[model samples]
Target: MAKKAVCIMSGGMDSTLAAYMLRAQGYEIVAVHFNYDQRTQQKELESFRAITARLGTGQTYEIDLDFFAAIGASALTDRSIDVPTGGIEAGVPVTYVPFRNGIFLSIAAAIAEKEGASVIGIGVVEEDSSGYPDCREAYIEAMQRAVNLGTRDETQLTIAMPLVHLKKEQIVAEALAYDVPLELTWSCYSDEAAACGVCDSCRLRLKGFELAGIPDPIPYRVKNGVS
Candidate 1:
């Protein structure tokens, strides 16, 4: 029997690459995406479906957690707060969705156990990311311990963080090497039709492509001030 992996994909470059990497390792993908009422929710959902179809993943989950809108303090979930366009900031960016990865991983653990999957893959980058606290390696490890302690005694799970230490450039390069459909992944925190190139997320993605010497396939509303 082939091994199974429940991959928590956000339809972003890093997460999408993580899923593809798992598939390369010969694990049957059980893709999972979350809809938490973010600004680019629709675009992300569309990308998720397309990416999974291309990957030919097994049973998929499109879980809705609308409570993030009500619990909104982040710019992605609350329109009141503007997503930063200047550059990546010093500490945790306003885009941090309040332990969002923690919540996502918890749900992923449930899916992994129920599906009889031994692995749970999450693409969380610490160094080249937008400085989200929940994306740190230490935090993910702690969450892994907690997830196992709370699950069934016989069910053992491995939380995989394939891109935790990689730079955005590395992620982009790896995705291309795996023939991942980069255009199908959405990274803009706002603006679904065309990426707002100056936003932190967009800038980081653009920077990655720039450093990788690859042109980003997605359309951007503007091309200036993307650093």
Candidate 2:
């Protein structure tokens, strides 16, 4: 039997690519997506559903953690804050959803433990997020420590961040190499039908695919309300 892995699939480029990498490594992929009161949560989950079904993953799990609203100050959960443009060069941006990864990882780790999975997969890219310390190697390592110590299982929980050190362009190249369906993933911070290219997440995604010389399969509404 193939070793089991629980992939935290957010239906973004990085996480989708991470799933491909793990599948390439011969792990029985079990995708787990969260609906944590995020504005784009529903659309993102839909993307995951499509991608996982296309890939024929063993099973896909969807969990709703509505409790995240109580811990919400970030732009993703709270509508008051605007998603940042440019990058988050100025410390952590409003888009940095306040320990969001930590929350996701903790929940994923729990589910992995229940499923008898020793490895938990998350796709946090360092190059894509320069300002978020949570995406850094040090932070991931610390989280791993917490998971290990906090878990009751004898088997250690290993956090797998395959794209952690790669740039967005490199990630795109990797995704293409693995033949991942990029169109099935969504990365826009906006809740609209099409991506708002001006937002930080959309801009970075546009730049990544452009730099990698690949056509972005996801449709985008033209900037300034022009289709």
Candidate 3:
């Protein structure tokens, strides 16, 4: 039987590329997406479905956690905390969903155990990220240990973070090399209709494309001098 990998896809370029890489390594993919009442929930779900179709993977899961909205800590989940559009700041931004990756990995661990999968792939880019504590490699590694300790004795799982140390430019180059459908992915922290070019997410993405010498395919509300 072919080895299976449960990929935690967020419908962004990074996650999509990670899933594609896993598939390239000869693992049957089990794509998983979480909808935690984020600002761009609909857009993300649409992208996830399109990515799954492009991958031609039959097994997929879309889990909704409404508690995020109730908790209301992060800018993505709370309406009051405006998403920073000025630029990438010095510390953990308001957009950092509280303990989001940890929660997602925990659920992915359960899915991996149920599916008898050996690997769980998550797209976490720490080098160019917004300093979210949950995106740190050490935290993820600790989570992996805790997950294994909590799971059945026979079930062993490795949490794969392919983009942990890569910068956004490198990720863009890698995604292009893999022929990932970049146009289908969404990275805007605010505004679902068109990307707000000033947001941290958009800035990083545009910078990546610029550094890669590749024009971004998605439309942005403000160009902000990004070619």
Name the better of 2 and 3 by lDDT: 3
Model 2 alpha-carbon miss at residue 51, Å: 1.0
**Lowest-scoring 10 consecutive residues by lDDT in candidate 3?**
218-227
* lDDT (tens digit, per residue) of candidate 1 on 89-190: 798888989989999999999999999999999999998767788888999999889999999988889999999989989899999899999989999988
RMSD of 3: 1.3
Score candidate 1 by TM-score against the native: 0.97
Any residue pairs clashing in model 2, and if so which? none
Against the true structure, what is every candidate's RMSD? 1.4, 2.0, 1.3
lDDT of candidate 3? 0.91
Q: Estimated TM-score per prediction?
A: 0.97, 0.93, 0.97
Instruction: Summarize candidate 3's per-residue lDDT along 1-227 as a digit string, tens digits.
Output: 87999999988999999999999999899999999999999999999999999997749999999999999989999999999888888998999998899999999999999999999999998888788898889998999999999999899899999999998999999998999999999999887888888889999999999899999998898876553
Worst 10 residues of 2 by lDDT: 218-227
Q: For each candidate, what is the lDDT? A: 0.91, 0.83, 0.91
TM-score for predicted model 2 compared with the true structure: 0.93
